[model samples]
Target: MSPLVKKSTGEFEEFDEQKLRRSLKHAGAIPSEIAKIIQQIRPLIHEGISTKRIFNHSFRLLRRYSQECARNYSLKKAIFELGPSGFLFEKYVAEVFKAKGFKVKVGVVKKGCCVKHEVDIIASRPDKTIYVECKFHNHPNRKNDVKTALYINSRFLDLKNNKANEFDEFYLVSNTLFSKDAVKYADCVGVKLLGINSSYGDDIQAIVNKYHLHPITSLQSLKKKHIHALMSREIVLAKSLLKQKKTLFELGLDEMEIKQVFSEIKNVRRSYE
Candidate 1:
């Protein structure tokens, strides 16, 4: 289809499986990572699913994956399933801070006043620690807004010890284009609001530009590439096995029995790959 005609359809032109896959690939995602993400959203696949819808669906699945697995799994793995964008941004944000010679840890579990919350990215120096919360949502809610404020305010004192520390600062990061009200609320609650492609405090663009971040595309690609590679390698290995000599005696089988082993291996590989 012509580019103009595709645009006229009111659907995003680059929102399908192939496009998403390419985006992910371009963003430097591995195949296995992409495949795991694909598995998470496979049940939702349908004939008419658009690329944009697919991307969004994959993102939601990633969030679900992170939230569910964070408690039990390693922080990096949970974040890996979250998709490239979140993973990458979280990574480089920490990287940028660390690049400046700071101590940084991604996905730190901290005790909040009412709950144990996983802060997206944490940076610490000799004097203080900074808590950063990252968000990429279509909309914001009042309840969530209030809770964020409480999170930051509550950060001043350790929930466990009720002691104040100088190393505390709250940074609320978002990919959604922030609204004036959202900025106001963030200010009212004493949290700094940051938006992708927009200035937050100072040199915000410098950091974004430095990383050249594309979270969704990079993540989807990594997942697909890793899984696809694994599938491909397994296929090659299975094929090689078929060409090799067969051992019938292992199963105490006759001549006909050895062929069954060959067939079974091929079938198993086919099913998995």
Candidate 2:
């Protein structure tokens, strides 16, 4: 019998080793490293083993093999580190859209048909204008619910009704997953949804990996205060750190720590190259 693994949500499901293999492969782990990691992990699989433990173990081992691959694997967790509040997340989302060639604005208030609404993101090009509402959750199991979909859709509707040709698209982007009802409601109302693994091809993970938009928090060397300092200076992306070496000193990192951070950032950037 397959050992049942406990999810972060307190639900238990049979462990699927193939899932782990796929994740490692996606993270750029070589065949030999994947095989070795699996060999070590198999013995540790027992009934009621938490997924968190498995992830931590795999991450530690993967980091030992390749820092780049480990950073790729940690992308989801790194995103969560962007916020206790959703402000940094909004900035990050704007950056993602900017990478896709959209002129982006964050936290802009636009007058709707009824009242003014402060949209999380406003991405525009000569062709189209997109309004995006970001739903960022620190916890993996916390999903964007139907109410969230409805709320964002209603706001979009108001804006759309105000000037139908003003915005071409409205998207609800979440750092986590969406509830089934949320997805259904979004599809029904024409509110496009983007989450960790949306049925839509342009999910958050896909976009991040495709554009090499990995956040600064992806670096394991940085502490929470370090992240805060960097973000305060509007330094969000890991690759951006390469150009701002002096900022690392401003964060109070010693010479060796700064070197280590630069090394890790280089490895992360090299992965996408």
Candidate 3:
């Protein structure tokens, strides 16, 4: 069951067990680990926080003594995971915006500091540009969520100051839903929040289910509509590999390697719809 449902007032109501399992799983915690941890902390979690916030609570508790361990096993993975997640999410948002007549550009910035901070998807129509930041965190708080927005906002300001023909709008997206305060902060800063689809949630669950069984990963094997969504990424990687053309054809991409890249391409192409 979904832990969230939109209320008449446009707010989301939280569920208990739904929060516990999803957050725990997102933090890279298995059921056994969560059972032990929750047995101890369940009493202390205040009523204000939902069950989903439990992962954040556990992470904060562990961060004091094992920063690197906590980060590597949980926090850092979630942060880095945002890059690929952003690539997928941007395709959806860009298509939606474009169908509504907005001009959308994907991965266009190729020079200078702008290159260092490429906005995921820029939705524009002559007079305005909208910068986007995508998040795929385990447990993003109001403060944590705002940090990326702040970075993007600062970057946008710098670009604008340099007369860089920038957009006036901004956006933030996440596979994980934001807290009330996170939404408020985004609104206050003129950042629009885009909710992720349930299908993506199912994809994460499938990944987790597969991991628990210690099965081989078939992410590089699945053929999906999102494959073309990877055009720019594949082009960039192919170019880099081409530059090191010592082995070229001799590198001899075996069937598995070819299948893997083909799977990646298929995944991106599916994103167009």
lDDT of 3 by residue, 1-273 (tens): 434534335566653655665665555556666666667666765534543355557766544444333533432333233344356445544554564467878766523334346667778887776766656554334223556656656666555555455568666755555555566666676667665322222222232222221111123342232223333333212212324333323345555655565555444334322
lDDT of 2 by residue, 73-126 (tens): 577788888888898889888989998899998998888999999999999988
Which 10-residue window in model 2 sums to the lowest lDDT?
195-204
Q: Per-residue error at 178 for model 1, in Å?
A: 2.2
lDDT of 1: 0.48
TM-score of 2: 0.77
Better of 1 and 3 by TM-score: 1
Quantify all predictions' global Cα lDDT against the true fold. Answer: 0.48, 0.84, 0.48
> Residue 57 lDDT in model 1?
67
**What residue runs in model 2 are displaced by over 4 Å at the alpha carbon?**
1-72, 254-257
Worst 10 residues of 3 by lDDT: 209-218
What value does the lDDT take at residue 33 in candidate 1? 54
Task: List RMSD in Å for every model shown.
Answer: 16.0, 4.2, 13.9
